[model samples]
Target: MIRKRKHVISIGISATFLGIFFFFITLNNVHTDTYDIARFSTAGETIRSPITIENEQETERKTRETVQSVPDRFNISTEITQERVNYIEEVFDAIATLESEELGEKENEDDKETNGDRLVPLSNQEKVNRLKQILSEPITESLENETLIQLIISPQDDREAGRKLFVENLETVLNNGVRTENIQSAISEINQSIKYATLNEELKQPLTELSKFAVVENSFFDVEQTQEARKEAASNVDPVVIRAGEVIVQEGQTITNEIYEELNLVGLLDGQRNFFPAIGLALLIFLICSMIGYELYLLMKENKLEKGKLISIIGISILIISVLKLVSLFLTSENQIFYIVPIATGAFLLKLLINERVAIIFTALFSIISGIIFNGEIAGSLNIEAVIYFFFSQLAALTFLTNVKDRTSILKSGFGVMVVNIITILLFVFLTFEKYDLIDLLIQTSFGIISAFLSVVLTIGLLPFFETVLGVLTDIKLLQLSNPNQPLLKKLLTETPGTYHHSVMVANISETACEAVGANGLLARVGAYYHDIGKTVRPQYFIENQMSNRNPHDFIDPKESAKIIISHPYDGAKQLKKYKLPKEIIDIAEQHHGTSLLKFFYYKEKEKEKEREEVGQIDESIFRYPGPKPQTKEAAIICICDSVEAAVRSLNEPTEDKIEEIVAAIINDRMTDGQLDESPLTLKELKIINRTICGTLKGIFHSRIQYPLKEAK
Candidate 1:
């Protein structure tokens, strides 16, 4: 009932924790929009539009200044028309001037150079003059036509200058009286073409109008401008504030002005009713608590501790986990740290308080709870990789701890943790991470491995404190008990030599038998050496401690003898408890005899009962041992060893055959009486145990002839 009450209270505490965890989760999600204010807001205010009144005024002023600074547009068509007319007039005047020059040059060469080289030929001179005339004709005519067009149009002074020069040259050529009919004809054709110059004026008007229309028009609003304006508007708005306990939003509902305003002010809000997150939190709490409970069960069940100790162990474990959780939270926002703490705690607990299997279960529970608490970014949500890593790291740490005793084993176990952690991390990265790179992946793996190793060291350091404070009987505690120098074992050897010797033999036999059947041989041997230690209270009363003396029990009544024999198991149990022997060994000491009858005492009592027929029926239960039969193979083996050793010792001249028969008889008797019924030993295993015991006893009691040595004179 007390145990049930403690469990109920523990469950209640776990449930309360779970409830709070879920409440927080729900509050966070429903208030997410409020939370998003942190992302949206700048400083203590909302992000604002860029187009403020000052900015708009500045833009208008800049636009006005830009318009004033820009140069006025000019019409290219009007300018081109005047320039073309002037160019035509200039070409015609130049043609007329070139014709006059050609005629003069030909007349001079003919009159002055004839006698220079046997007189130039008239035909050659005529051909040269004609070629010069042909070239000058187009030039002179083109100039005359340009000058005439410029005169007719009264073109701009800048355009008419070249045409005026050409006309002057044409007049100079014509006054020379050189016959130039072809040049005059060309000039006349050019003059007729001068009428087309007015077309330029018509084209210029529409071109200038098109240029004026092409100027860009400013607009009241543009998309880019609007965005900037909105930004400025948002920036000008003040931040909103919300205090704790204010309902920022409701679940499954659209956000409202109140929610938005509150969120905007404070830059955060808690979640609302989120069922999945709440359920996940609840499950996480349950898993962690359940793991802790199961670990307590493992320790208690192994040590066979009483209800009080069981409660204390469980309470201490819960307290440790809680403290670790608190420490994990206080450390930082790094969720990996949370995982590291629990994993390390579990590993240390396994090394110090329980076995690796229990540690592994503990790690699993911690990983899940951590995922929920840290929200799965690090520990991973339903993360198969995280689960696998937790299991593998726990297994690695635990497996490497086999037969660990000293500080050096801690170092070795740490190395093992590193190896396993690396493998698990690699597996996770490859299987889960998408943007995988060798260097980053390796770094993550290395960090995990190093953390795992450090956890091992920390756990080893903390183990002794927990063991001493909690008075927990861990496997390490058992190993310590198995040491040869313990005071009780030393006292047993010194005070009662015969019993000590008997215990040593029983240790050997029991250890071998238990080992043969895959039981805890160290525990079996240790327990066997201490089982009959209470016989030292009256050493001579038990035959094993009688040292060649007459049997004292022979003088006592059979009922009294049976009473003395039956009292030893209980007495041994008490003595062991008084000395603080672990419950497992004490149970072995108490239950080794089970309820088997004392044959000699039983037969003698039957004879006495026949003599006193009127006496009430004998209570056979009283004659038998007060026993809870051997529940484990180790306890069963110890029982068999005790009986076989006593029976074998009774022989005056022990031989191999006799030892075998005696050992077999003890097994058959125990089996026939159903003392072995509750033990896990199978019939096949029992047969093997019997054969092993017979073989061992044969070697112990082997036959040898004694020879007399003669003395020489």
Candidate 2:
């Protein structure tokens, strides 16, 4: 176990190192200078114009100027000036003085004229015209243009006051003796100015006040516009470009510092050279090693030195695969060529040296390793196209033809590989590189097909060497063993007729039992045939061989008799090993008897002991066979069949009902005693096994009657 663990740890470390090494090496080999050429296809192609810093600044300035040109109604300054205050006061004083004088005159006229009366209201149009004339009669000619004016009087009062003021101003102006046309023009100009001044002041005052409190001093030169200009400038700058299908360097291009820098900038350079490829190579090696380890585990499961053998197998297989990979590399710079050779070699080796399933699995793994190695050159980087081509080609080659017994199937498989490879390559090309030129596509397609055919041919050629070197008993070898004409089975049939007959019956019972419970029936049947061959060593000592002789147990002590009976399972195991049988067959031989007691001998000993002393010491366990128990259902079923067959042969008369009762009793005894616990057979499956055993026994042990000729006598 310790050795096995150490081997596993070693393989794990090796695989890890290999994967990292290959990754770096592949990364280093990648051409960084080619990227720029690949990005930009042709020399004469014109690039887009770039935006300069000056241009951006000019655009920003223009945007600011446009925002500033929007018109506004007010100036923030002079809205609350001393000139405006003075103008308001002067207008108020003038109106007050004019009202006082008019009122005084009216009061005097009223006193003289006998009766006082209220003034009549004027029409709105007349009042408005009169108010316009009054405002034109400038008592506030010194007022600033920026003064705020508001007419606070009621409409009726405003009209009346305006009319009175206008008449007074007209009398004053006429008294100055101005010409009529000049006066009219002057009045019209004054009226227009007054109206405009009043409205302008009203509009300007509020805007001026609002402007003082506004948060932004200027609405021009916004943040959003500035950012947009910067983005536009950046976008207009030219991007680095590259083009496809251009080799920037030749095969012998020097590994210079400039090239290294460029590769590093593009994240393609590896500091440690050769590491990436080595790591990739190591993964393939490790996988092969693991497969060998698993096979060894299967082979050595029943041996005492299982762990040691398993480790040795893994180590040896790794060394072999690595050597093969290295040799292929020396032969071809193209990894695809190397990949084809190893997989073909591995598959053929596995078919002959190991089982076909193991061979198929190894082939699959090799194909994947090939794809990794050939990716950049054959299929362009570690892509699905390369993987698919490798997988389908390998699968077609392995599964299309069977029985690598001769060179014919190998040739047939090579043809099948070509067909499959071509199809796979076409599929990959169509999916990945949509534009297909007939000539280039066909050449690449042919390469894949030819590689697959070569792989099959090479695999076929290597099979015999692997088989001879490894001493592997493959499925094909086992199949050959099954032939009736084999020397070993022929010898057994001739020399030990009764044992051969017993073996045949045991095979039937074991196969049926295995099948009923979904175990390997063929293996079970084969194992049962070889399980009791050890009995041939002392054939006369066994009851089946001593057919017409006296019983051998008559003169023996019951304890000694039981000991001989129990030793048969161990003896059978030893004989099977001498013949170089598989561990599975030996296991069935050793466990068929389990730890069952020889009841007749045990009871006889018990009765004799009771007569000899008041209470004698007795070891009941001595009567039972030594056992590791039946680990498989087939072995357990064979045990039952062996007992039932022997028991029924001794019966004078047998019936179907009687046979069933005896079979049920024996099965129930086994279940109660935990004899069948190790076997995975459930209660339901056991019932089926029991019924099959009884039915078979009944057929073999059917009743036969002796005929009497009394009438002729």
Candidate 3:
């Protein structure tokens, strides 16, 4: 519970530090400045738009103009043509009915009669009046009485011909649509067609007059259609936008009302405070911090998050953000200065000091921040080019720095980053299709080269600081310590050369086994080199150093021998601590010989006790090495390999079966005795370690075939 609380507190502190750093660094970029000048005033300096916005008033005006310019729509309804034709048909049909009725009346008055006796055959005026009553009011009112009377008095055949001609002419004129403006012309056309017909003057006059009644307006204005047309026109009008960084007013130029409104629209006017950009920036920071916190929590769960690593990550992130902020202060839309920021320095440092995952996470986070920082003074906009450039540059660094063996690898990785940066810049330029002069291209390319150089310089310079100040054990530090000239290694080599040889053998076997189990092979090898440093304190007491076949242990009491043997692990740990080596190295030195019973010494003392007939008086604890046990895979594997190496060396003629037997027996002893219980090694990994160790041992101790020798030929 206490450890859990500490992890939570550490995560909180890391998140808070990064959050505050990110917010303050990017705060000014998202902030907008208000101007004090008014409309129509002389400009002090050139003002650029802080935000992108639509000019609604200008857009509305364009829409209004577009809508007004759309002509009023009229509907040429087809039903009107049919209705007018029906009117003409009705008049002809009425005339036929009247003639039939009049004839019937005449026939009723006399079956057969002379023209004078035809009941004074109805007069044209009386006929007209009867026709008016018989026909509908509109038809009657439209045609004059004289036209009707002429139709009444004409011969039946002549009247039928006139009616047919009139109807034909009227239908033709009316079918062609007549609006309010063109109705008179349509009526005149009909009258001309009728007047030129082969009919009498009386009939012609009546038919000419009949054309007026037939032709009427057929087309009318449609309110809904006109409104719909205007709506469509309005929809097609595009909104006018004032883009961010657009010049609102030129320097030394009068600030017109238009420019003033534009400045106001972009929130550069007085009394304008857009907290939205700040809020958005805060949310972005929150998201980045949340991701970082989750990643740290995962590392903590995996037991990879040490205090030094956590501090290093926080320190690197703060340093990178601060540098970005400082560079962004002088940034302009015209200048591409962000390319020289040396962002890959953070990636190198993180990868070397910590792990790749943390480095990658921070790289991506920094890339996102780069988009905002290098936004060309445009708030609420992301510079996609900057994002892509940083992401690719850092990714190239990570890819090229596959092996962090030494500082030279970092320099080579910096070259790779430089190449990628140049290519990325070239890609942006080519994709834009803009013509860049040779000098301009060279200048941009130089920024990429400079950026890479800066990254290498900073990484090389700061690497030692982090290693020394934070006690972060990187691969480079391990490699440095692996050098044979180191003080502790030299002491171990000269004073205990036999022990040193044995240690070298153990180091080889331990490195192989640890690597097979997916542990730190370098660290395992380094630890093995110094694991038996305590033997240097009394080199002759150890069997390997007693070269003359004389036993130093034979003169010492068995109990006293156990005390000397048990002090070695602790003494080596003390020496390592005094030298201020990494804690991992100290752990290996301290925990290689865990609390396993020294059976040979214990049995020897037991035999003495048995001679006195007091076997139960021998305390088993006194013959055991005091230990906290191996707490890691590497340390645990070293413990098993250390015993296996010494035990294998004891055989007079070591065979493969003998080597395997001793290795398996020692591993079984460690497992059954619970010495490996505290270490994180699983049964499956231990099996892998067993196979790897046997393979390496076979290679180290393989036999050569003996040949029969004749007389010295």
Candidate 4:
């Protein structure tokens, strides 16, 4: 139920954050301004489009023009050309038939009279009528009476020659597509061909007249093809779009109908409902928050999620977004004000206070959000330049801020960010091809330089507040605590020098061992330094601090000595809590002993009880330190190192072999004693830890060269 409550609260917090983000993003997008101006009225101020939209009216007009510009498509009919040629052939064939009919009548009449008297030939006028009857109606109607008569009276060879010339020329003229406008010109060309042909002059007139009948408009209008051509032209016409930031009207200029329509098209005019930008902003905020929430879920599953880190993420995100929005107010096309925003500050803080992965994820989110927020010219339009600038700036910080332990590292990284920012700015400037003055160039580069420094400054300032207020122990905090001059550390050094020295040694061993097993080595080291702080409560009771070669436990009762030994862990925990150190540090102080029995006191008491025949009365729990056990890999590692360091220090002659043997034995004893049961350390990690500790101890206790009389010299 408690876990469920945490999830619910976390979800609620995430929802609240998303709501706030949506509100901020929508501030610029959602407009409530009323434009009282009307069409063809003078404008009070220049109006730019708030949103990008297609001018459907203008687009349709352009499409109409484009479609009209396409000429009508027509198909030339080959069948018509062949039919015209056949008509000319029929006229000549009819003339030849008249001659043949006249010759056949002459032969029959000669047979009847027994004399070759000339038979009555068909007259030219009679032949003309007969020819008209034999030919098609279109051919007969097109030719004149005198033209047909002339062709009938002409020699048959002249008629044949005229027919061949007219048919060939007619076919050529008809084959070349003739529309209604060009049909007369085509007929004239065919007539000229007939006039120039090697035909009898009298027949040429008839053939020229025949050419008129042969050439009628062979090419006709094709409605389907014309419609298809227009459709293709319309499809090619691009939509007319009035882009965001485009000037709809200039100040002191008349607002014409076109300009007013454009204003209405882009949703700048009053009564135009535009909810798309707000909807888009809401969706963007939702997506960003969902990703962050998922990251938090992963952290929670890994037991790495703390209230402090969660608050840090929320706080840093809010700070970055608020900064962007505030700066966006100053941002303009003439001035790239977004360049001066300390966007990398969020990346630095997240990396230092929380973790790098979260920093990277939020950096990209910040960059994207910055792009939209810094779009000063218009709402719902992206400034790709801003996105590229912020991303590289933060990415540079993430890349170079490598040593979180060093306080100056953030500043050092700022230099890298500065270089990258300047380069990114220069890239924009050069790529734009627009002329920029020297002052403008300097000012833009200065923004990049200012951004880097500002990020460093803000990150440095915010870190202590988060570390102190949230009770979070970061690497920098650990580094500071490791200083010997720190209050608790100094106290340990001045009051219990022997134990202090032992702590330093244990810290070294624990750090190495923890790192070997992929655990937080710095955390283990810092924890180790404070783990023996409990021993400082009664320093003389601990063997290392009994420097006078005397033991305080010698005079005390075995039960009292055991109680004093066990109380130290809790005593150190109390002092640490009093100082309000982070929970992890206090945990190490409290759990390093891990409920292990004080064997010396326990055995001593057992001996006394055995002598008195009261061994059964002695309880093992009385001699054990009260512990919750080491609950983390670092805490578990500190526990083993703490015992191993103390055990090795007590050895009369510590050697490489002896150190290795004792390290392995101590780790084995801790495992068997179940001191590490609660920790997440695996058997494989334990083996690795064992080897690391042995190597570290062996290095520390390696054989030293003995000097003879040279020492006195």
For model 4, the superposed segments whose C-alpha errors exceed 4 Å read: 1-8, 11-19, 22-27, 30-48, 69-232, 247-276, 377-380, 577-580, 653-661, 704-713
Which residue ranges in model 3 land beyond 4 Å of their true spot? 34-48, 73-225, 248-273, 614-619, 709-713
- Those runs of model 1 whose alpha carbons end farther than 4 Å from true positions after fitting are 1-273, 283-324, 327-342, 375-396, 405-408, 415-472, 607-619, 652-657, 702-713
Candidate 3: pairs in clash:
none
- Indicate the residue-level lDDT of 548 in model 2: 89
The candidate scoring highest on TM-score is: 3
RMSD of each: 15.5, 16.2, 7.5, 6.9
Off by over 4 Å in 2: 1-261, 267-339, 342-366, 376-380, 383-385, 397-418, 425-474, 485-488, 607-617, 648-656, 680-688, 691-713
- For each candidate in the order shown, give its overall lDDT on alpha carbons: 0.59, 0.55, 0.87, 0.84
Q: How high is each candidate's TM-score?
A: 0.57, 0.54, 0.76, 0.75
Candidate 2 Cα deviation (angstroms), residue 674: 3.1
lDDT of 1 by residue, 1-713 (tens): 47546655654554455445434532332222324443323333332211111233334455555545444322223333334344444433443554456567667767766855333434433433443454335333433332333322333442344344434433333333222234454343333333233334532332222212211111122455455555555455443323233444444445555445444443344334234444655565555556655555554444343443444444434544454445445433222343344365466565456455555665665555444344322211343444556566666767776665565666677778778777766665567547766776666776676677667666776666655555555656667776768876776777678888888889888888878887778778888888887776776787767778899877989988988888888888888888877777898988899888887898888888888885666678767886888877889899999989988887898887788788888898899999999887899999889988887887788877788888998
Best-performing candidate as measured by lDDT: 3
lDDT of 3: 0.87
Q: Lowest-lDDT window of 10 residues in candidate 1?
A: 210-219
lDDT of 3 at 6: 95
lDDT of 3 by residue, 1-713 (tens): 69779998999988988899889878777887778987788999988887888999989989999999998887776787777777767777788898889879977778556544545677778888887887888888788887787777777788778877777776676665678999889888878877687877777877777777777888789999999999999999989999888888889999888888788778887544668888899999999999999989988876667888899989999898888877877787677888888999999999999889988999999999999888875788888888898899888889999889788999999989999999999999999977999999999999999999999999999999998888898999999989999999999889988999999999999999988987889999999999999888888889888888689779889999999999999888888988988888898988998899999999998788888887366788899988979988889999999999999888888899998898899999999999999888999998898888889999988998899888885
- Global lDDT of model 2: 0.55
